[model samples]
Target: MAEQLAQLADDRALLGRTSTAERVSDILRSRISEGFFPPGTRLSEDSIGGALGVSRNTLREAFRLLTHERLLVHELNRGVFVRVLTVDDVEDIYRTRTLVECAVVRGLGEPPYALDALAGSVEEGRRGAREGDWKRVGTANIHFHRELVALAGSERTDEVMRSVFAELRLAFHVVDDWRALHEPYLARNHEILQALRAGDRDGAERLLAVYLANSQERLVEVYRRRVGEDG
Candidate 1:
């Protein structure tokens, strides 16, 4: 009985540790998306661990997770840093998203689950936008599109789309005016949601394509201008 109780305690401890690591990862990822840790910003294990009241081991695990998501780069001997999104990265992600997302929509015939998920995300984004929470808005925006892509019913596509959005979040940080960059899209997202709800998959796909293309262009311009200013 004592042995069994000890084993249970060990399992609880492990679960608690894992939960802490996950929470650390989520907070760091959100900060990265919000531009708190811009491209090339080095993350010090000791400093970050201290700030978050986590152990160095936990912080390292969180860093590894973010690196896998492409939001951080782990350099040999140099340490981990926030990844800078190159123009090539932006273009490639946009192209891939367009292809996969459009295909997902095309194949989704009256997928109420997907439609409802998208709508829910859009409403959340609207609320976030109204509350002036650009970071939350950005997250909701990704969630909406991610749900739409999940309609493709391909686990592989979902994985690819997740990476694409991580990279896109880096690009979003380049915009100086966060609200300006995201506000205009809320209404467009609703339009897409309405079309999807109405079972107009083709129309939704077309609108999404245009919306993504325009968003890419705007983000690219913002990145260029910001880079120029920094230079």
Candidate 2:
């Protein structure tokens, strides 16, 4: 009986180790997205590993992956923390997104095959927002923009936009009121969809440009306000 119990314990432990890595990744991602783990919060391998019941090695691997994606930054002596998005970072990301998304719209002589996907993502965003699932709302928002960019007909552009979008997700974390920050944009998204559906690419492009600029300003304001409060 003791041997059987020991075997059961081992099985549970193994299962936990596997599960812990996935759970830890999700937890860290959500916290980063929610601004709970802000820029420059030192990530101690031993502490996080213990907290998540993951091996130090597994945690390090996770850090490395995020670091590669530019979501986390690693310093030689200071350790890893969430990447801080600066003013320049915001400008660059917005510029790239605007350029890419505009090109995507221009490329559309008529609505591309991906219009349905974009519509679906908008609905997903609305549903997530209605359910008060801000995280899902954020995910849907990213997907919607990503699908728009994909219409540019370049795989490489999509890849670059994905990376930028991930960093933007981190920036969105700075907003204090999640629903207030994201809810207002849902209708604007639907409006863009309406224009696109009518094959009004020029109008859609103009609206997208304006929307992205406003979003950047709002995000920057929130970040500055938060930083000032903390200081």
Candidate 3:
């Protein structure tokens, strides 16, 4: 808890002054997505509130917001903890991803869309791969998809997927083989980026669809077995 508190202290500057629930929730959400608050980890309101220099009410509201996002859960007497996603949750998340991500690609009005962020995320994955940091690779992979979704230029869509992807990270934590989970996506991300750079929207969309489908299958299978073992 001390380490977590220290980390939150470092991030406190992000809140600036007059911390609102939205800003507090954003910090907590980013922390959860980064695996700082892994699944089933209980959140201490007092500790976190003190760490961020926010009031108890403000911190509770932030927890409430994240609960709505499926990143946190409140138990009657046990306090809030990061959520442990079920296999069905994993499947539903991917279904949502497939629908939104593919639609974003398909709805692209023209070629020569902004490709810089996408290219950067692809390169980020490669750098992580070379460094043997599979967790970093996974993060970069998520960034690649986030950038892909950004192509839609819809703030609403971005807001929705932010929660979805954070929820997806919970599923990712269940996997023991991070490399097996993230390594394959590096080349695939580059492939999609190349296609997009060449103005091959159809090809990019096709690649993204297949990529999401394959990822869903692999992740769901692992989740099922892991959940069963836990049960």
Please, what is the whole-model Cα lDDT of each candidate in the order they appear?
A: 0.78, 0.75, 0.92
Pairs with backbone N, CA or C atoms under 3 Å apart (clashes), candidate 3: none
Best by TM-score: 3
The digit string of per-residue lDDT tens for model 1 on 112-217 reads 6446677789999999988999878878988988988877778988877777787788888767787888888899899988888777888888899999999888
Deviation (Å) of 63 in candidate 2: 3.6
RMSD of each: 7.7, 6.9, 1.5
User: For model 3, how does the per-residue alpha-carbon lDDT over 145-222 read when each residue is reduced to its tens digit?
Assistant: 999999999999999999999999999998999999999888899899999888888999899999999999899889
TM-score (all chains, Cα) for each model: 0.79, 0.75, 0.96
Best by lDDT: 3
Off by over 4 Å in 2: 1-38, 46-65, 229-231
Whichever of 2 and 3 has more lDDT, that candidate is 3
Please list the residue runs of candidate 3 whose C-alpha ends up more than 4 Å from where it truly belongs after superposition. Answer: 229-231
